[model samples]
Target: MRVAIVGAGLMGAQIGCEYALGGHEVRLHARDLRRAQQRVDEGFALVDRHALFTADEVRAAAARVSTAADPGDAASGADLLVESLPEDLELKTAVLRAALAEAPEAHVATNTSSLSIAAIGEAIGSPERTVGTHYLNPPLLMPPVEVIGGERTAPETVELARKTLIALGKLPVVVRRDVPGFVWNRLQFALVRECAWLVEHGVASAEDVDVVMREGLARRWRRVGPLRAVALGGIDTWNRSGRGIVPDLSNARELPDLATVAITEGNVSDDAGARDAALARELREERALGAAR
Candidate 1:
């Protein structure tokens, strides 16, 4: 399969590399030539460490990667088109419109973390051909890809996306409904908002809270969700424990009602950028080392 990844940022590069590793021809497109070249260099460097390909092999694999300044040119001859643009509705809509216009024959997938898939599809004027393939950070390492279907998304399109993602060596979780934030963000934000409330109230130190989660809850969470974990601990005990455990939000301050405000206020975590890049590099190295073994 020939895959075209629009956007050569962290997610785009990681996903493009994964497709290449899966033996598909991959091309990375960027609006900026320098960024595109930089991404290509980074991709090779990361893939080389995984030793999935030697320097020469990486070069050969990367040879399949071409950069395009124009969206239409980038999407030409693509079987699958993945858009990894910024998490802005307007920006994504514009990009999707251009991509759909350019690659009318290709299956379109958005790597949107929280946007509405239906809205995105509508913007592109082809709801049936559009689906959401939301990947966790560092796509090369994350096994689960949420295959989200919008209200207008055709069943066949969703299935094709699922099959294609599996063929690219990813585990795809099909989501029947296309809700905002989807499943992952809703679950994650629920916990995070509570954690923020806890921190704001000084109920537990950050380190301690992290310790309790990683050392205590995370181990069990791997096998079961919070509800099931509590159920296994005895539903009676869980019910009793929940009686007085309501999170206190008196001290919680609203950063801003809108996400744009929160970002402008710089309340968003700084670690996300470093963490994304580091994970990609680390995963590449790990894969390379594992291949050597």
Candidate 2:
């Protein structure tokens, strides 16, 4: 498989590395070609450090990735063209237009965190080919990839995307309806809103919220997931509790001030390097735990 990835930033480079590691040829397109290649190398190094694959396999996968100067150059003769650029609609539409012109037969997957796939398709004038592939941060370590099709998207395109994601060792979750943030971010932001509300109302500190997630909710969810965990705990009791609790949850329409206040008033770490190291360690532990099970 020949994969063309636009943008070559954090998500782009990481996603390209995953495709390359899956034994597919990958071309990363970015204005800063050197930086893109460097990021790709860094991705492979992270894989090696985690011992996810053998040394030889890592080296071979690293060799399979190359840098492209432009969208046309990257999308040329490619089977999949993934746009991992910024979240701007106009910019993504323009780039996809140019890239798709080069590989008209290739499937289009836009890596949008929160954008309407149908809107993107309408803008690009290729509703049939465009699909939303919302890959989580650190795509290599995260297995659940959302596969969302626009209203006009062909069934074949969605199926091909599922097959391709499965081939790259990812769990492709096909979202039946087109919704904002898809599944993961929707559930994630709902929890975050409540967390923020708790902090805003002096119900809990941010650190305390982290503790509850790390020590309680996350651990239990890992074992049985949210739905099953609720089922195991007696759904009838949950229903009774939710009748009172659900009404009290945050429903602020505007953006919450918690994040802004945290950045300015609270001691939030801006050390990207240290944060990345910590995240990598956690991901490695997660992988090991999964393997053990």
- What's each prediction's clash count? 4, 0
Tell me the lDDT of candidate 2. 0.86
Error of 1 at 289 (Å): 16
lDDT of 1 by residue, 1-293 (tens): 88888877888887887777677787777888787778767767856754545677677677777778777777888888899999888887777677667778888889999888888888888888889999987576567899998999899999999998887657899988888778888777766666655565678865566677767887679669888887789999888877767544333343323332122434345665555556556556655686799
Residue-by-residue lDDT tens digits, candidate 2, 1-293: 89999889989999999999999999988999999988998888878876777899999998899998889999999999988999999999888888888998888898998999999988988889889888987787777899999999999989989998988878899999889888998998888888887787898888788789878998788778888878898999999999998888899875586654252543435554465566667666776897899
**Listing every candidate in turn, what is its Cα RMSD in Å to the true structure after a full C-alpha superposition?**
4.8, 2.7
TM-score of each: 0.81, 0.90
What does the lDDT come to for candidate 1? 0.76
